[model samples]
Each structure stands twice: as structure tokens, then as C-alpha cells.
Target chain A: MAILNIEPNIAQPDDFYEALIDMHRDLDAEQSRMANAHLILLLANHVGDEAVLREAMQRARALVPTSSDVSTRPA
Target chain B: MANVDREYQGLAFDYVRSPDQDARVAVRHPVVVVGAGPVGLTAAIDLARRGVPVVVLDDDHKLSVGSRAICFAKRTLEIWDRLDCGDQMVEKGVSWNVGRVFFQDERVYSFDLLPDSGHRRPAFINLQQYYCEGYLHERTAVLPAVDLRWRNRVTGVTPDAEGVTLAIDTPDGPYALRADHVIACDGSRSAVRSLMGLESKGRVFRDRFLIADVRMKADFPAERWFWFDPPFHPNQSVLLHRQPDNVWRIDFQLGWDADPDLERQPERVRPRIRALLGEDAEFEFEWISVYTFACLRMERFRHGRVIFAGDSAHGVSPFGARGANSGVQDADNLAWKLALVLAGKAPDRLLDTYGTEREYAADENILNSTRATDFITPKSDESRVFRDAVLRLAKDHPFARRLVNSGRLSTPATLHGSALNTPDAEAFGGAMVPGSPMTDAPGTMRGHPAWLLSCTGDVFTAILFAGDRGFDEATIAAIRALGTDGIPVKVLIVTAAGATVPSVDGIDYFADDDGAVAARLDARPGTCYLLRPDQHVCARWRTFDADRVRAAVARATCND
Candidate 1:
């Protein structure tokens, strides 16, 4: 086992989360998309494991709303 | 050290009546540069270095009043290095890469402008514009080919087939001069551009900023510090940067309604300064001013023999440190091309490439600064909401951090698809691509420590990279034939660690030890690169083709 267990990997996650939010703060649509792409590559490099990255990608996609899933939300 | 008035600089270049001072009439010069600022001085130096005599005229003899245009990007440093004053400026300048951003009171994150070492110069250096002006002025004074005239105001410009004639007004009186070629490096309100009825077209940003220079004995490290809605200023943004001479620059973004005169008053500025530096931070005022900028440019940089460079050619907001930096590059780009045309090395039509290449750089600087300005000063309610949301998210997530743009620090403009470049005949992957400034790599020349760019000194250079695969003497001699004693197109053979140097006169050999230089250039065996006088890689190949190399060299020099 690769020991990819989640035990609050980053200390002060709240602070880290705030910093991330600030980074994306004010970018236009095209820039925002590029930022997301760059962020993924950066984090993936840090993770550096094909299996772990695939698992994380799957988890992320599962949480994202599809077109069909969007109809369930309040208009 | 001087008076606190922001409008005047204590140091100035000695303004003497020009040797061309014919009070009754005019004088004819080979080249005339309008404006004695950094850009004009650079253009004059480049021309003089290439053997074209030049005369530089300026309305004022003093350095820019404030600590203006503080950040010198690496590419600009390289360009300045070729002009013979880069080392001096770097020695006196403070170099740094760390930039910190704060949202409200909490510190958000910090980023490195140049994360890696192993290069000739750093990512950025902070030096006052006055220091740069002083060094350039000193360098220009010693040049035999340049006649720098101060307090010589140009009032009119009339262009003709042979050249252009300028009407000047000096303290002694008015006179006229004819120039084979004229370069407008005048400041934003270019008299030459205006006289020629040329106008820069673009949107003028409504937002204004108050720039203040303060000096104190604080122990803060020299780095860029930017704040979004900082606690002291409440909703407005503030930026703090340290410059040479213990001077600190502070820029406060004042909305459209800011009272221009009122904001610059010492009374109004003191409270904010106190809050930002703490109540008792004892700082003496050096200079202060309010300014507005627009990201605008002329439709074309070249108008026959009367070409425009610097702020006269284009103007961008000061946020990205692009104004003076890009303008200096314009001077560099045009100097070599103009020199070639003047010396009959290339056809007159070659001058048109200057406009095309510099226009590309101007557009890039404008685009980057525009985006940064929009992000910094959101115009609409929707934009403000989005900005605040991003800022809020930026504090927490790495993804949000990527969206932050505090004026993406200036980088070298890649002139992709330039007309001067020879497009790669074969697919390749490497740093030294066609139309890109040649990247520096560590190596030894003649068995001594050196970098690749040091060999590219102010001439048409061909770097023949023959690694483990040895080169035949005939081929080496053939390449060497392209250069003569008078027409030196330096041909250097680069080989990795102890590869026997090919025996050929007039062919320089360099050892790329440890393969660091070769790998950096992405050069395999038999790779050859042709660089322009500006050290920009104009053409490259996987294998050497003697005839093809000759043609590429000709094309690069505008000889084809």
C-alpha cells in the first residue's frame, strides 16, 4: 500500500484554503480556466503517483455537477 | 538627500551648448535621436557602436524626478549589458525575486519571480531611474560618434524622401537640422509624434494612482509588497517596494474621483504613510506625484525614416514595469536594423521589420498590463464581486492562487514568426528557438569560464554545436569563410568535454563541459544556430547545411 491515507495532510488547511481562494480572486473566464489547468499539473506533480492522481481525479469528477444533475438545483 | 519637491531631481547631466551650435542656421547629421532618456540614449549608443554617428537632443538635462521605472527585467539587463553599462547598474542595484501579496490585513501568499539560479543575471533588479539615466549619460558622453545636446527642444519635424528636417529651439536661439534618419524616444507627450500628427490610439484608464518616494533607515528587505484592500487604506489598494539609496516607493490607487492636487498634499499623505509604516516609523519625504496612464500605441512604429520608439511609439500602464523596459527593447531592436541599413549591409526595406517586431512587443506589453489593470481596478459591480470572490478564494485554495495577477512581472518578448527569422525546416524542441532571445548557458571559452551570450558580443554570430560527433576540417573552414577581418560573423564550434577541437584558423572552439550548455540549448550533434547582432536566435538546424546557413545568415542581416 502506498499509504495515501488522508489525515489532514496539510496543517492549517483553513489558511491554505484562504490563500488558494485569493489566488484565483479577479481573473477573467479564460485566465481562470488556464489557472485551473496549471493548478492541476502543479498538484499532480506534488502527488507524483499515477494511482493516487487517478483516484483524486475520479473523486473530483464525481463531486462536479453534470448537465443532468444541474436541473435538480434551485433555479 | 535633496529637497522634498517631487517635481525636480537634484542630479542632472551638464547641459552645454552643442558643438553643432550654429545659432544662425542648421546642421546635417547622420542620425538624430529626439529625447535623451534611457531609450534615446540606448538607440544612440547602439548606432554609434555600429559606426553610425548620432546626435541626441533633449528638452531637459536632468534625470527623471521620481524613482520612476524601478524594476529592470533580466532581458533588459542583457540589452543594457551590451551597451557597456549593465554591470555598473547591477552592482549599484538591489536584486530580488520574492513578491508578497496581502489581502486586507492577513498575508495571503508569496511568489518568486525567478526561482532558479545558474544564469548571468537575476530575474529583476531594483534601481532608481535616475541612477540608470546617470550611467547611460556617462556612457554616452565618452562615445566619439554621439553628440548629446541638452536643453535643445525640437519644435517641428518635416519628413522627406532623403531624410527628415527638424526645427529646434535652444536657449541660444532656434535652428534647423537635417537627419538621414530620426528616432523619437521622447516621453509620453512626444513633440515629434505630435508634430508629425501621429496619435496613439487606445482607452485611457480612468483610475489614477499617487506614487510617492520616501527614504528611511528601515531594515525591510528589498522586495515587492502589494496589498488588496489593506487595513490602513480600507478599500483602496496599496503597493510598497524598496529601491536603491534607502528609498521606498509607495503607490496608492485612487479611484476616479480622487482629488489630484489634494491627494498629493503632504497633510493628506502623512496619515496614510503613518498607518502603513506604523505611527513612529520616522521617514523623510523624498518625492511624490499623481499620475494617470493609458495602454495605447500608434498604428505603426515606423513612419518612413522618422521611426518612433519608447513612450512615443507606445504607452502602457506602469503596473508591470513595462513602460521604460519595453521602450529600451524597442531601441535595441531598431538600433541593429537601422545600422545595417545605414552601412549598406542590408537594403533600406529592412527598416520595416523594426516596426513589425517592436509592434509585436508593444501589443504584448499592452495586453499584459491591460489584464493586470482590469484585475486590479475592476470597473463594474459584477467585476468587483468577482474580484472579491477570487480574493476570498485565493486565501484558501492553491487553484485560487493561480488566478492572482499582481502585474505578471515583465519577461522577454518572444518575437514568434518574425519576418527576420528563418523558420525551422525540421521539428525540434529546445530553448533557443527561432525568434527567441538566445538563452544563456554555462560553459568555458578557450578553456576559461564563460557563458554562451558572452560570445555573442554585438555581431552576427553562428554557434556551431558539434558535440561527440567530430566535424571535418573542410566543413569548419567552409563555415569560417562566411566571416572576414572587416565583416566578422563570428563562427564558434562548441563541443562537450575534451572532444578534440577541429583544426581551423578563424574558427573559435568552446568546451561545453558537463553538457550543461548543450542540454540548455537542446543541441544534439551537428546542431547549428545563427544569431542576430542582438543575440536573438534567428535560425537553427538539426544538421549543418553550409549553403542554407549562408542564406539564413543573409536573411538575418537583411542581405537576401
Candidate 2:
């Protein structure tokens, strides 16, 4: 299996992070969550390699609270 | 200036009045085509080329009223080339392959449609639908086998086991006639389809669009421009294309609740046009129309002696320009099968493959068009959020740009799983797969420069790329022995780049020249290909044998 190659491959990493945050401005808590879910799925589909995608998913999931989804996460 | 007026004055062509109805009532003609539009005319012309007598009936003598179906795709052009009009169309059409898509107020990206060369036709051309019909009309006029009647409308159709009886309404009077086959080339609102109790079943899009054709003097390049939520057209999309005769076709998306009547008026639309093209941009309104469409197809395209071609078979939203393009394709796919069946060369079941293949294409067009419509006019907030995100990401990211499907431009449909196709029996590589239409390449025919596809109709063509051992007299006899009149298959021996193949009585010879044809087909010197009359591949192999070629030809004609 191929290892994940997620080491700041974007040309301008800081600008991409700023753009992601800017997308959520002026939105309520629920809208921000929906936008996050959409961005994840969009980026996942773009990175169609399944092994790399699973690695990215696992790495991101480790940072979030396991019980954080009980009340607020999208179904 | 070539006159393009607001009103349509029908081109003056000699309209030969048919003889008295009583005199021709009992004679059953070989083929009768209803609705002498582009599709019907193409079907009639192709049949006449194969020595089939055809009768074409049209309600009106003129071309289409508005500048509808302005984009002619490459495959559609190739089909027209077979009908003897593709070169003239490319000359008269405004050819372009670049398209720019804008999101909100910012230009997201631009793409080139045809990056490679050596093909006969370009990726796409913008020609008014009426001009297309006019070209078909002029070409059909020279063929005496086609009897075209103006002011004649097929009012009723009666189909039986062997033939069909038609009641046609004429300017002089109503007349009854009979034909061995009836091909309905009528438009989407097919009266013949309605008479058959077939309903075009699909959800009517709540969305509507306004199409305005304008003649203007502008320096903008001939490229397709699409906008999503521009500052001028707020909260809606706009598409602009350049057509021949200095005419510009523009489409504006209006919400479901927009008043169609008020939106189509020139006075109300001029300000919107001015906002996009500056206020001082002087332009004359040529035509205006409002359309709302659905993706629909008949349950079947064949009904015994009665067959449907063009808009009569299927229809889709106008986003991808699939309507007229697919209609032309429908005629191309049906004409050869009908000619063979009428000649008793192939079984009647061969006609069944026409419905199967074209219906497959109709489904593909509908699927793409419906997806495009949804992406352009997203239904809910959830969908719009993703659409905006994709558009926003596309500005800088290369991968995101490919996901943006304003309209996946029209391309040729592969007749996958067609009953008439024979899968390869030997090992091979790269294109020329069964059911794929053959790609065109520049080559020399006899001693003259020619496009390969322009030489491919009228009979089943087996292109034999002969190797060092060319073909001995016995081998040549084996190739000739594989065909009968019922399933006529002809061979073309394309020798290697420098080798010369001796020309025989009926076989055509061509050299690959710069190896473009061989490179395009990924073919070696020993490769052999069997193509249907319409230029779609039926089977291919690396070696040639008489028995295998005969079986492949038999399968292509459905001789069982």
C-alpha cells in the first residue's frame, strides 16, 4: 500500500488554509459544520487514491473528540 | 452584408408538386420520410445514396425559424460529411474550440476542445440550425432518387406487417399513400408519436431559459463564454456563442417563476444585453424564443414498418446542444440498416439494433445534460454550497477545474453492447474496439489527398493494413469470397508507409503517408478492421482469414 504524501504539497499552503477558513465566515454554527463536511468529501473525491484517502481520514479523525459527534456532527 | 432579417423568408427552391394522389395511391414506395427537417432529410439522402427511392414530406418549405442548435459537434460533422455536406458546413461555420467559464465575477478557467491535429474536422463549429438544414436541402436536390415534397404533412400513419399507409395533408388536397417503411423525422412534438400514443415521459424542468439571436459587430473572439451569477445577470447563469452570419446566440437562465412572455420581449431584454455587452454596443435583434425542456425518450424507436429518427425518438435539455446533434446521429445509425433490410441483404431484425444503439446514445445524452442542468441550477442550499466551493477551488487548483461541468461538450457515442457488433476474436491493442466509431485521419485516396472518413460509407468496409507479404492472388480471392450481396463487405488495403499495394478491380488502395492513420488506429501492418456502413467498428483482428471475415460480416448484418 502507498503511504500518504500529505506534506504541504500545495504550492501556497498558508493561502489555501486561509481560503478554507474564509469560506466559513458569516455562517452560523450549523452552516460552518456543513461546509466542513462538504469540503472534506470534495477533497476526498479529488484524491481518488483510496489508500491515501483512508490515511488522510484517519489522521484527521485522530485530532477530533470521539464523543464530539454525539450532538453536533453531520449524520 | 448577407441579409439576416428578423423575419424568416424561406429560401426559394424548386418544389416539384407530386402527381395526382389517385395516380400514386396504390404504388408502395420504398421509403417515406415524414418532417423534412435536418434529420429527415439526412435519412432520405443517405438512403438515396444507396440506390433506395425515398419520398420526403415536410409541412413547411423553409428552414427552422430561429437560430436553434447552433453548435455542431465533430462526430455530427463526420456524419454530415458522409451525406456530402461536411466540408461546406465547416467553411460556412464559425469554428472554435476554446471555451471560458466564469464563476460569479471572476474568470475561473479556459479549456481547449481539440488540442491535436491531423483529423479532418475541428472539435466544434457554430452554425445556425437553419443553415444546416439549408445545406442538407441543397445537397439533397442533386440526387434524383430523393423526391422531396413541400407543404406536405403526414397527418396519419397506419402500419401493418409488410408496409405502412400514410395520410398526408397537402396544399392542393389530402392524399393517401403507401410505403414499405415510414421514417418519422418529425420534431420533438411529433404528431406521429402522439398518434401512436407514445408520451415523452420525464420530469418537466421547473427551470426556463430565454434564447435571443442578435446580429452585432464585435471584436470578441469566437469562443464559448459561460457565466455563473455574473454581476449583470444576478443570481442566474448566461451562455454566449458565436454563430455564422455574424449572429450571436445568447441564453439566459430565468427562474421557474419568471414570466416567459415578458422576458422574451426585446425592450425588456435589451437592457440586460447592454449590461453584459456595454450600453453603447449596437446590436440588432434577429430572433427571440423561450424554452423549457425535459429529458425524454420513447419506449421504443422501432414499430414494425414505422421507424422514428431525430427528435421523434428522444429529446434532452438544450444545455449540451444534444437535441439536433443526437437527431443527426439517430438518422445516421438508422439509414444503413434500413437500406440493407429493404435490399433483402440483411434480416429485418437488423433494424432492431438501430433502436438499441440510438436509445443507448439517447440515454447518455440525457444523463449528461441532466447532470449539467443540476450543476448549473442547483436545487437546494446544500447543492449550491458545493457548486460554489468547486467553482471557487477551480480558480487555482488544476484538478478542481476538470470537475466543473458547465456542459460536457458533445462527443461520439460508442455503441456498447450493440447486437450487430462482433467482439474481437484475436488479441489486439488500443482503439478500433468493437462498437467504437472509427477515427478519421489525413491520407491519400488513389492519387488525391482525402480524409479517411469521407471514403467510408455505402457498404461494410474492411480496412486491411497489409504487411510485408502484402496479399497473394489466392489471399485476395479469399478476401473477395467472404461477402454476398445480402451482406456486402468491401476491403481497402492500406499498405505500409512506403510499400505499394496493387489496386484490383473494386478494392480501394491508400498509403498511410506520414503514418497518421496507423498511429491513430494504433494499428500495425498486419492489422485488419471490419467497420459497419456508418463507420463504426464491428470487429477487428491482427490477422485476416476468409472464414472469420465472413462470420464477422454475418454478425454485423444479423443474418440469422
TM-score of each: 0.86, 0.90
Per-residue error (Å), model 2, residue B222:
1.7
Kept native contacts, as fractions per model, are 0.00, 0.07
Off by over 4 Å in 1: A1-75, B1-9, B23-25, B485-488, B498-505
Candidate achieving the largest TM-score? 2
DockQ versus reference, model 1: 0.05
Per-residue alpha-carbon lDDT of model 2 for B1-560, expressed as tens digits?
55743223357544556774667555679899998888998898899998999998888777887778889999889998888889888998999989899998999999998887878888899988788888888888899999889888778888887788888887678888889998988988998888877776765788989999998988778999999999999989999999877789989998899999999999988988998899898999888988888888888899888888888888888888788888888888989889988888888999998888998998999999999889898988878877877788789888778878888888878988887788766776666678999988877887898777877766788888887657888878877765454476788778667776666776677777878778877788768888888999988888777677778878888884
In Å, residue B315's CA in model 2 sits off its true spot by: 0.7
Tell me the whole-model lDDT of each prediction, alpha carbons only: 0.83, 0.84
Span of ten consecutive residues with least summed lDDT in model 1 chain B: B1-10
Model 1 accuracy (lDDT, Cα): 0.83
